[model samples]
Target: MWSTCSLARPPKQHPYENRGCLLNDDVSNLGKVLEATKQTLFSLDTGYVSLNRILCLFEVWKTFEAKSPSGLCVLMLDVAELFNTFDISLANATQPADMERIPREIEENIGSVQLNLRLKDALVTSADHKASNRHGPGKDT
Candidate 1:
C-alpha cells in the first residue's frame, strides 16, 4: 500500500542535511520541477496572460476586507494530516522523467531566482557587518 507523509517541520538550514530524509526529497526536486512547469505552461503567450490575470485577482482579493459580524466573528478550521489518499494513476501521469532539467530551465528563463538569492545573501552580509560595526571597539557588556 502506498502512503504519503506531510512534512511537519520546515526545511533544514543545511542543504547537505537533506539527503537520506524523505521529507526533503520532494522539496529538493521542487526547484527543478517548478522551472520546468513554468517553461511548459508559459511557452504559449496565452498562458502568460492567464497567469497575469490570476495574479491580478489574487492581489485584489488579498487587500479585500469584510465587515465584522456583530461583536466579532470567529472562524475555525480543522488542521489534520491525512496520509495515503493520493491517486497513483494521477501521480504517475505527472511525474517528470528528468527532474534536474527543471532547475536548469528555470535558471535560463527566470533570472530573478539567481538575483533573489544574491539579494538575500547581500542582505544577510550587510546585516552582519552592521551588527559588528554597532559593537564598535571594546565595551563588553
Candidate 2:
C-alpha cells in the first residue's frame, strides 16, 4: 500500500518533501500562540484561575513542549509544584517605598505637580468619553 502511494510522485522526489512548506508557518505561529496565551492569562482578575483554564494551558504547553506521553508525568509534577508555590512568589514581591507618590513613568507628566490628580482626571475623562460613545479628538458631533 505504501509503495503504490509513492508511485504517484515524480521520480527522485520523496513523498514528504511538500510537507516542509508549512514548517516556517508552524514555527512563526508558535510565537503568536504564546503571546495570545500570555494575554489571556494576564487579563485574569486578581488570583482567579479555573480548572478549564488550567487544562487548556497545560494542553497547549504539552503540545509544543513534550509532544509525547513519556515526559508528561514529570512535567505535570513540575507544573503542580510551580502553581502550588506561586503565591509565595507573589507575596514576596516588593512594594514601592512610597505608595502615595506615583512614579514619574506612570505620572501624567514627569516633574509636574498634581500628577496623581491628573491620572485620576484622565481616567474619568476616558470613562466619560466611552460613555458618550464619541471617539477621541474631534469625533464629537
Candidate 3:
C-alpha cells in the first residue's frame, strides 16, 4: 500500500546541496532526511562505534566528496580486547590465564596502543581473572 519510494535517487534538496556546510547551513527538510538517515543507516544504537558504522557514514559522505574528520585511523576490534590496553611488566602484573586466542587478541590490541600505555593495572579488574572459573574466557570457563 505504499505509493512511492525511490532508493536510487535522493530528494531534490539533499544534504549534498550544502556539502561541507552541513552543520552551518540553514536547516530545512534535509534535517528530516538526515534524521531519517541516522535512524536507518547509522548503526548508532550502541556506543561500540564499529568500523562498519563509521565506514557506512563515510560512504555516504564520499558521495558528496565531503571532507573533514580527516586523517582518521579506523580500527576494528573485538569488544573483549577493549577491556584493557596498557603496558605492564609481566613479572609484576596480573594477567588472565590465556585462552585459545584471547591472549593473541590482546597482543594485537597492544600494537594499536603501544605509544600510550605505560601504566600497570590499566585493565586490572576485581575478578580473579588469573585462574578463577567463574565465567568468561577464564580458561574457557
Best by TM-score: 1
Q: List pairs with backbone clashes in candidate 2.
A: none
- Which parts of model 3 have CA positions greater than 4 angstroms off? 1-43, 47-50, 53-65, 70-141
TM-score of each model, paired residue for residue:
0.22, 0.20, 0.16
Q: How well is each residue in 13-93 modelled by candidate 1, as lDDT tens digits?
A: 323343432334554553343333211111112222211222211111111111111111111121111112211111110
* TM-score computed on alpha carbons, candidate 3: 0.16
- Cα lDDT tens digits for candidate 2, 3-122: 000111222353435443213343335434444332122112233231123222222232223222211111111122333433211211011321122232223333223422332233
Q: Where is the poorest 10-residue window by lDDT in model 3?
A: 1-10
Model 3 backbone overlap count? 0
Q: Sort by TM-score, best first: what order?
A: 1, 2, 3
Clashes by residue pair, model 3? none
Which scores higher on TM-score, 1 or 2?
1
Q: In candidate 3, what are the lDDT values of residues 44-112, reduced to their tens digit?
A: 123333222212322222211222122111222232443353222221111122122223433464432
Model 3 scores what on Cα lDDT? 0.26
Report the error of model 2 at residue 102, Å. 8.3
True-vs-predicted CA distance for residue 39, candidate 2, Å: 17
lDDT agreement with native, every candidate: 0.26, 0.28, 0.26
Question: Which is the leading candidate under lDDT?
Answer: 2
Worst 10 residues of 1 by lDDT: 65-74
